[model samples]
Target: MDSAPARHTGQNGTGPAGGGALAPVHPAAARRSATAIHPPRGPRADQARFALRPRRVHRRGRALPLFTADALAAVVTATTLPAVAPPVLSVAPVLLAALHAQAGLYRPRLAPSALLELPVLAGRSAVLWCSVAAVTAAADPARAMGWSALLTAVCLQVVLACAGRGLVNELQRRAAVRRPASALVVGPGAGASAVAAALHGRPEFGLRPVGLADTAAPAEGAGGALPLLATHEDIRRAVIQNSVGHAVFTRPPEADERTASLVRLFHDHGCRLWLADPAGTAKVTGMRLPHPADQLWGYSVQPLLPRPTRPLERWAKRGIDTVLALIALVAAAPVMGACALAVRVWDGPGVIFRQERVGLYGRPFTLLKFRTLRADAHEAATRWTVAGDRGMSPVGSFLRKSSLDELPQLWNVVRGDMALVGPRPERPFFVAKFSTVHPGYEARHRMPVGITGLAQINGLRGDTSIEDRARFDNHYIDTWSLWQDLWILARTAASFFRFRLGGS
Candidate 1:
């Protein structure tokens, strides 16, 4: 559904005092905007892609100065004490950094404070010195730190570390006041407005509220002096146009589907996400606060880590796909040959059909299949075919029903054009059409296209609800594992052998 035009606020902080009626946008408006926003062809297209590339600096860059501060403190402590050997200086700094990282000291915080970190800093410092003493004793008993020396070293390290971190925090605060990062307060009601107001009133937090994203309902007063973004398109445009770096949710993201859907959108755009509990209702909603000290203007806040990209596991999945796909093609070569001969004989010459289908990241690739029907380019691309169609020959119907026609897609999997398991690829026309109508339909492109998927196994093939299929596809991705892929393949194989007529 299209949303209303975004509402803006005045400099005096006066805005709409109540929710306004949402106006519907033209259905094709989103599609038109998408096409217009993307450069067709030129140097400008390359520049646009480069500008929108996922930014890795947002989280890591901010943590670098603190890491440096901790490193400096470790080095100073090692050189200042006779109990610490020269070789210990190098190892101590590395060890201290690891310890602090485990304690979450290096995490990006909206409101950073050295004083609040004292307890954790002191504990980690003590552990570092104790470990150093133990290592020294193991190498040379005489060089080991004594009790008095160890105590002095711990205290000195804590003091220096705190002082160094304190200085870094002050510098960061001053810099933030000068140039705050653009942010959006997500959620509706008075809660969102209060949080946005807090961010605007307090510069130390380093986030300037640029807008309010309230997909669930109209935000009261449009979150005070900020435009209300009620649609995904509006929020996306705001993020790109204003260079928004932060997204603060007034409630837990899991509060509802409308709110939960925004997570993938923001993460894909490289925005740092946070869940802020201003009403102290997170506990009631079963939201777990892992870090108590992390806050934004007295409101409990926590960073929402992005979905983990298991590189090793994904590499393993690719390896399995290549190996198994190659093996399957070899094993089924005889059956594929017989099917191809039958198609050539019955369908009058064209044995192997090739048609363009949308694939990973919306890239188009020619999909291979035993000629199931003899349709012209326009009919094949734009028409939807199903089993028992009068246009299809007996051979085509049997091949599709038995899924013998899909054997060629194993080659696609082997060539890395598709995964053995993922959301099924569709034609470019259908992809564009479905995306605008169904929520989360476009998100299916997040993963590689597949031959068979969760939706297929659950009987969503042929004519089915696009919305449900999108839901299943997203769920599969969210909980995907190598084992799940294997299981889906196993089930697909079993069903194929049974000669199930679930074909499209």
Candidate 2:
């Protein structure tokens, strides 16, 4: 069921751009010129905006062939067994699949071979047939399978399963050669270049290296070896332009903070991530692979699974947000109306201030707050205002201290633009500046922007350390749960009455 790679590229990395080599752009210049804060306004800008949305999972089909081969093998082997009732025989395929899955037999592998899996397949087959013999004996002793019959059944099952799987592997290899997925090799210097070259030389691996992704600039004269993707923006553009399906890490992602941050970016784009130790010096860090280890050519490989997202829990959280936001909006309507009236009287005309703020996946959305200042739109977006700013009226100061200006964001939660509990959203200008300054600042966008987050509840409100806030936000996301959200909300409500200057 796996579809072939959408397009084919020539020997050079460029696919639709023809076979010419691209000029390398310096990493520093790219970062300096990157429009991470304000994207250009055009068709390309619109495309980039839409590209930030989470992509659909694509590699689900890659495991279907192995599942099918195992099921068919189980069914065929079941029929050859003697003295088993119809009901007992019918359970063989289902039971065999469970055993194979438990043994990681169906996991997608870079170099899949029946010979490498023969022992596992044989051992699982033995378990399946032995259980069948036991069931037959318990049901009817006269019709029970004997020891010799059970042994033969196990052998027959193993042979048939291996043959089917071997055929599947051959077909998969042929299909991969015909249409290889676009991939990005991530690492700095010679390590990344070597892996990219190996992948380019070996077509059977089903990966066509499209570029070398690293935060560091490539060495002089190395640009012609492959197009160097020096910045996250450059990498994002390459992934979208090439329809990249895979990202192979030359070293453990945790080895460096700059390299470590790209994990969420690739995951957001739905790429199959792999850690390959090409130099054999890479050490396994804290992150663990869900499936068994694999190999790419001669180098050891392992699939890099991100932190458990808990999708079911996330969906539940969304549902809770919508219901609770609606209720909170309805319950606070009188208070919100009074605040709007105060703002209108104090600031005149504009009660609701809408500004573009960076949200999940770094997408921009209009965030709503009561107009707390009389500044113009450009100044409001770019300038940092303090608590005792002369521009602020008494109404604005009270709103800031009491945290009443953010009540309007309840509508954002109801509209799916934000969540009830998550990392606080920030202006695009500050986001761009802090992302460059802090190591893990950009990672805060992985979750929905919340009106009250763990950082804010734990005294990380306005005028706090950006690094500490980023750390707390990431920790909240990594260990997020419904209970923790409720706890944060409780803490926020408990301290809502306390006077705090510069409550953002």
Candidate 3:
């Protein structure tokens, strides 16, 4: 059979080491060549040689599969037993299975030994059996025999499955001693060369680099004893002829379409395609694959807590806020009414103060508060109010110190403009300015602004450093939880009383 042709200019429009333009193979031609090379035969004569194929080589440790199969068998056996029945036995096996799975005991990479996992399975099963017996003693002593019988069945199943998997693993290990997969490393660039080197270094990975397909003339004795098969255009043909099962595209081909088409061609021929990261080949550690949604967003917006309960939970929270806000507003009506009367008597009648503040997602909203300042305070440039500011009306100072000034924001929360706990909203001007100074500042808007937050509990209030305040805001966003919010609320109450007693 004629050797398959390669397509595309090697790395930089250079020919193969032998100096001939590589030939391109049509998809049909490549498929025919693969078939022609491997004629079907009966069972392999030598197990060791057959085991050399990549598909047959199980690089992942042997123990993991054994442990998993045994654990599963134990759980199934326990569940099937009639004697062990109750909240104790039923929930225990399920919980242990979940925990074991989470601990990576079932993963192919962490192959644990059957013997090791068997003890763990037995221990969990015993715990479940004991719990079941205890429950039976309390509920009905007569059921104890049925429960014990079920636990015995579970133990037997676990032992049998563990032994079976161990035998299979031993067989596979013996097979691996035989056949190994032959590989052709197409080193078109630094990335490709690096991949080739890695495969060469890890021979147990079942990759045999027959030769490198360099477009440039092979350096003097480049292939060494390995054959320098073909160049760029002949890559596909060469890969097909040599029975390559993996093609790594380290660098882009001369034509984008050609590269894309080549990847598809490889895939059609059952070759695994691995593309090098375009961001440069610096090895990355602890790299987590992003979810499909994360990929779509181009960024992460996960909360520290398990995804916010559910829609019903959110609605419940909103309902609680609305009911509480309404009741508080009603209870404070008399005081607010009296305060209005006092303001009318003392400062000539604007009892309510309305100021524009940034709200959710930077939207502007009118913040309602008791008129603590003279109405004309904004006539000059807007400035942050400080402790004992002369602009504060006599009545306003008492309102501000007591936090009665912020009670009206219950309305904001009720109106859905704010949450009960989140980063405190910023003034639109500050939001704009700070966002420019801090690139990640806008991430705070991912949740609705809140009436109070971690910053408030930490004594981060008016005129505090914006950077320090932002740090608290980010901390709240990152570590938000209903429990954390409750803690902050408790602290806020303590601070409120302390502030009230201390006065201005």
Candidate 4:
């Protein structure tokens, strides 16, 4: 995106040591500064990390009471129609589960009410019992269930399901009051702090405020012993360390790039991000409120991330990766062997230069490239570009320009260290440097690093703005699909011989 507004700020937007804004210091100094803050640890910290698990009833847990009630209802319905009881009892619960899933009965919500969902239950039960009657008729025409039997089944299902779920809701409310999920409040102004305070005072909401992320540094004791995360790094470190599962942002995520960056960061770490209307006054245009209740205290919560799509697409990605890597490795073996020989003959040794590059999820792996320069370990690690170095080695120039230097990374793809198409992997030095300097740089790790990527295709390669490269990479991941991967692969292949060394 555009250049980051400004560099590091302490809590409440204050500069470190009264500088108004801390100047960009050396990376080593910045690392030391980041290391200085020691967040609270021990039993309380452990509790914060583990609290989200079994913290409240949601998703499958919410469905449990309904399932139990439906089972009881199934018995009653079947007994009424003794002739078809066996088949009805065998299929009713399983069919209801599928139908309820489609009707969003399994979807988790912060404050769910069984009583409010009575209409949905009744409607689904009607459809479900009718389906059972139709299936029984098809299976055995002589023993088809009657209209009276179907009506009884539907009525019993709704009443029994509602009764069981009402009991579950009451039990769940008590449990939530006892143990709540850890939450982080994010936004500018006192709105975030106010919502956090309200949660602290009320235990029934099932949210325990662990910290706050705001544009300005919190006033002394404003957070009430909770941590303040002013910078993205601080936010990331805090979220990971404290096991923060929920994020409550007072403003809409679309308010600015910073808020958008927060969405990517939380999504990468798998946190549930929520946009909160703390005062419940502001409303974004074209936003539809969820049915029933969607309030946390006075704040209205809007989830930032959409529910994940079909699992088959994700499974297809792995299948694509493995299959394509194997084919590419075999197909390119001869070319790689030739490049190795060329390097050995001309460069005198060290045909393959192995360096640790940051990959998916900030994990490091050894990336293999043909040695093109005679730099020492320190120079290799810290050097930014060698596009026009006067090294005077024709062999090195040929390998770099021809893109033969990257052939060995096909092995990385096969080993699952990389993908055939994704953001190019950067050395650990640059990963650290860019992650701090560029907003959303670390978010690139959300997808596997690759040798060819959208950034390279768009010409944001060597010596380009790190911020723009991060932008394109994140965009690619955000819109990633199997077809997109195939298209990138096709473009890379079609341009393989003619592809410039700029992307190198």
Best-fitting candidate, scored by TM-score: 2
Q: Compared with the true structure, what per-residue lDDT tens digits does model 4 show for residues 304-332?
A: 44322456986687778889888887988
Model 2 per-residue lDDT tens digits across residues 113-190: 888788888899999999999988998999989888888889988998999999999998888999898898887655
Clashing pairs in 1: none
Give TM-scores for every candidate, taking all chains together and pairing residue i with residue i.
0.54, 0.57, 0.44, 0.54
Runs off by more than 4 Å, candidate 1: 1-60, 218-224, 284-292, 308-504
Let me know the TM-score candidate 1 reaches against the reference structure.
0.54
In terms of lDDT, the poorest run of 10 residues in model 4 is 12-21
lDDT of 2: 0.73
Off by over 4 Å in 4: 1-60, 63-107, 111-175, 178-198, 202-204, 209-316, 497-504
Over 241-273, each residue of candidate 1 has an lDDT whose tens digit, in order, gives 667888999765644446667887887778998
Q: Which whole-number lDDT from 0 to 100 does residue 419 have in model 3?
A: 70
Give the clashing pairs for model 2.
Answer: none
On TM-score, the stronger of 1 and 2 is 2
**Residue 299 in candidate 4, Cα distance off native in Å:** 8.3
Please state the error at residue 395 of candidate 3 in Å.
2.9
